[model samples]
Target: MKKAIGKAFLAITGWKGEGAPPEHGRYVLIAAPHTSNWDFPFTLAFAWAYGVEMRWMGKHTLFEGPKGWFFRAVGGVPVIRHERRSMVQQMVDLFTEHDRLALVVPAEGTRSLVPHWKSGFYHIARGANVPVVLGYLDYSRKTGGFGGLLEPTGDMRADMDRVRAFYADKVGKFPEKFGPIRLKEELEADEIAAAKLAS
Candidate 1:
């Protein structure tokens, strides 16, 4: 019933996806182009269509009433982002507790452009000794997809560069939704700009 409902909703909303089913593993699933609220439901529909059951984290505040019940049924887990708890430690605990689970996390962490992406996804994958699955929502093609699994090697900067390069030319149907990838030089320049502004 859940899968049928999700598929039907996607069809009605004209949401299209092109990803292969996610494999079962202890993985950090990173969804891209998270530029809108609708991405969540769209991605959920796509996941359901592929019959891939994944547990994803969201801010604790989003859980409420019947909606919360529904999200829980669909494998939603609340993450207290503001807590002092180390994200790496939390992921280690979760992966340790749940065997062979795919913990989906949004690498961008928001619908807006930032100087850089949240590194928790990288840290979680490394700490848990799992693969990182790069999931994408290319609004340009009205499509979504996932690449082959990637295992983090603890070299943060190098690993991120590899990941970014993989998706660089992957055109989306909604080009406007795609954000610019801040290159290493761009990151340093942004930091310098921020420092100047602060002074």
Candidate 2:
């Protein structure tokens, strides 16, 4: 029923998916160019269309209300973003516990522009000893699906370069809001320097 609903949603919206979802038992799925609210529903539809039951994290508060049960039923996990807990290790432990887990993370972290992407997804995949599947939603083409997988080599710069290349051609709903996909460390220094100069 979910699969059929996903297909119908895509068909009605005039959107098509390209590649198949990951066939592996465990991996980190990172979606890019998440610049609009529409990305969420489109992503859910794409996943269901491919018969992929993916787990995604939401703020802990989202899991506290009446609709919380519905969210959990759809694979939503509560995450305490402001806590000091080691999220990467927690995710790694989840991989260890589950024989098959495909965790979906939106690297951009927000719909508005940011200087760099959050590196939590990369760390989670690396710590869990799993591949990172590149998921994309290209609004220009009305297409969305997995692109491919990346095996982290502990080389942050090179690995992120490949990620940027993969998403280079993918267009988001708000193109101006999508910045280059770079590491947080790389951009933090620039942000700090800019702040210093402004003072």
Candidate 3:
């Protein structure tokens, strides 16, 4: 049902899916270069086309009433904005509880351009001892799908360097709206290192 729905949607929208299904049973899927509202549906459709079940965090309010069932069926996990548990921990817990799960995390955290990518996806994958899979949407070619899988090597800068390379050619719906593929954590580390060297 989902595969058919995804194929039909893509065919109607004229978007082509590139890349293959991930081989890992459990991993953190990084939804990157998110620059438009349409990314949500396209991302879901791309996942469905590949028969990948992706769970993502949605607003707690979005899960209210009858619409809640639909959202949940589509792998939307309601997250309370003020919850005490950090989202990373919440996601890690979910991973620990499930044997085979693909937690979809929009590392950009928003459609608008930001200074850096959020590091929660990296932290969650590390905490759960799972690999991080790069999921991309190249609007330039109207293509979307899995690009590659990367294990969190605990070396932030080196790991992110590899991530940077994978997305170097991927374009978003709004190219100007795509920010640098970097983590603030890494930037801070670089600052700290420079400070130490100057001293």
Candidate 4:
């Protein structure tokens, strides 16, 4: 039934997935091109198609009531951002408890463009000693898949360079949009720094 629903959904909307780990240890899944809310369902469907047990963090409020049961059944972990709880700490704790887990985290934190990404995903992987897999939703290709796995070495700028290179030339399906992780202020800063060094 899961495969049927996933196939039917993909036939209509389309999806392509790759690089999904097969029963791996604790890690983080970073999905990008997050330019629309549609990304959530599409990515989730793709994950289902691939038979991956993905866990996602949602606001604490979303985990209460009948709807909460649905999310929990799907492995949703309600997070209270207002509790001053460190996301990285929570993830480390969860990973310690689970031993083997794949947690989905969106670096953009939203569909809208922002100057600098939240950077929490990077921290989580580094702190938890886990691989950070790059998952993506590319509207242009009508696909969603995981990219290369990155093992962050606590070097933020250098790691981000590799990340930007991976998503370069990717396009978003939405009008006036490119890749979700592209064209940020940090990219501009990197370019300027490189130019200065070259000069």
Candidate 5:
């Protein structure tokens, strides 16, 4: 019934999905090029259409009020942004607790253009021992859905290279508001490479 509603919603909005959802029962599902508020409902719509009971992390404050249960009912997991590394650990622990979890992480962290993506998704996938799946929104084509599956090799650059390739052609609703698909951790990868050359 919910899947039917989701599919109808997408059809009504004239937004269609591209590929099938990932087969992994437990993994980090990243929604990329997230530059607009509309991404939330559309992402949810796709999840329903694909039969993925996807859970997303939202600001903890959102879960504090009377509507908290509503949010949780729709698969929202409250997160305190300032917790940083601890938040990653908590998400990893959640994966341990649930036998089948599809956590949708918005890598951009906000609607505006950002310099780099938060690395928490990468860390969570690695720590949870689950593959990372790319969920994309290409407003240019009026299409969006899961793209590629990446198994972390602990080599940040190599793993991210696969991520980069998948999103290269994905365009956001606000194209100017979308920055490069990069993680701040890649800078550390750069430093490691530089050090090896110097030594």
Candidate 6:
């Protein structure tokens, strides 16, 4: 039923799916170039089409109200951003407790432009000893799907380079709102170097 619904939705929307989800029992799935709200529904449809059940974290407020049941039923996990607790640690613990868990995270953290991507996905995958699955939505081709699994080796720059390469050709709904895929620390360093050169 879900697979049929997913296929129908994609067909009606004129979108195509590519690649496959990770075959591993446990992994962190990170989606990128999330520059529009439509990315969520499109991603959900792709997940259903592929028959991959994934749990995704969202703002705690999204889990409230009458519609909360719908969100929870569809594998939505509420995350309290204001809480001091380490989200990466919490995710790692969840991975530890569950025999098979696929936690999906939007590395961009928001549907707006930012200097760099949040590293929570990398930290969570590393701490949990799981691979990172590269999930993407390429608006240019009107296609959405997973790319491949990346094993985090604690080399942030090197790992991010591969991530950047994968998303290089992919276009977001709002391309202007999608910044280069780099770590915050690396972006800051580049800014500092540029400032020094100007001075």
In order of appearance, the predictions have TM-scores of 0.79, 0.91, 0.94, 0.84, 0.91, 0.91
Residue pair clashes in candidate 2: none
Candidate 3: which pairs clash? none
RMSD of 2: 3.1
lDDT of 6: 0.89
Q: How accurate locally is residue 77 in candidate 2, as Cα lDDT from 0 to 100?
A: 84
lDDT of 3 by residue, 1-199 (tens): 9999999999999999888867779999999789999999999999888899889998899999989999999999887768898878888889889988999999999999898999999999999999999998998888888888898899998899999999999999999999999999987887899999999
lDDT digits (tens) for residues 1-199 of candidate 6 = 8889888999999999998877788999987779999998888889889988888987889989998999997889887777787778778888989888889899989998987899999999999999999999999989999897899998888898899889899899999999978988778878999999999
Candidate 6 total steric clashes: 0
Question: For model 4, what is the C-alpha lDDT against the true structure?
Answer: 0.76
lDDT of 4 by residue, 141-190 (tens): 78677788898987677788888888775565563543345324567777
* Best-matching candidate per TM-score: 3
TM-score of candidate 6 versus the correct structure, residues matched by position? 0.91
Candidate 1 per-residue C-alpha lDDT over 127-173 given as tens digits, one digit per residue, 9 for 90 to 100: 88888888887765666767767777766666767788877865544
All candidates' lDDT scores?
A: 0.73, 0.90, 0.91, 0.76, 0.89, 0.89
Best candidate according to lDDT: 3
Error of 3 at 93 (Å): 0.8
List residue ranges in candidate 6 displaced over 4 A.
Answer: 82-84, 191-199
Candidate 2 on 1-199: residue-level lDDT in tens? Answer: 8899899999999999998876798999998789999998999898888888889988889999799999998889888777677777778888899988889999999999988899999999989999999999999999999997899998887898899889999999999999878988767766898999999
| lDDT of prediction 1 | 0.73
lDDT of 3: 0.91
Q: Of models 1 and 6, which has the larger TM-score?
A: 6
Please report, as a residue range, the 10-residue window in candidate 5 with the lowest summed lDDT.
78-87
TM-score (C-alpha, index-matched) for candidate 1: 0.79
- Candidate 4 colliding pairs: none
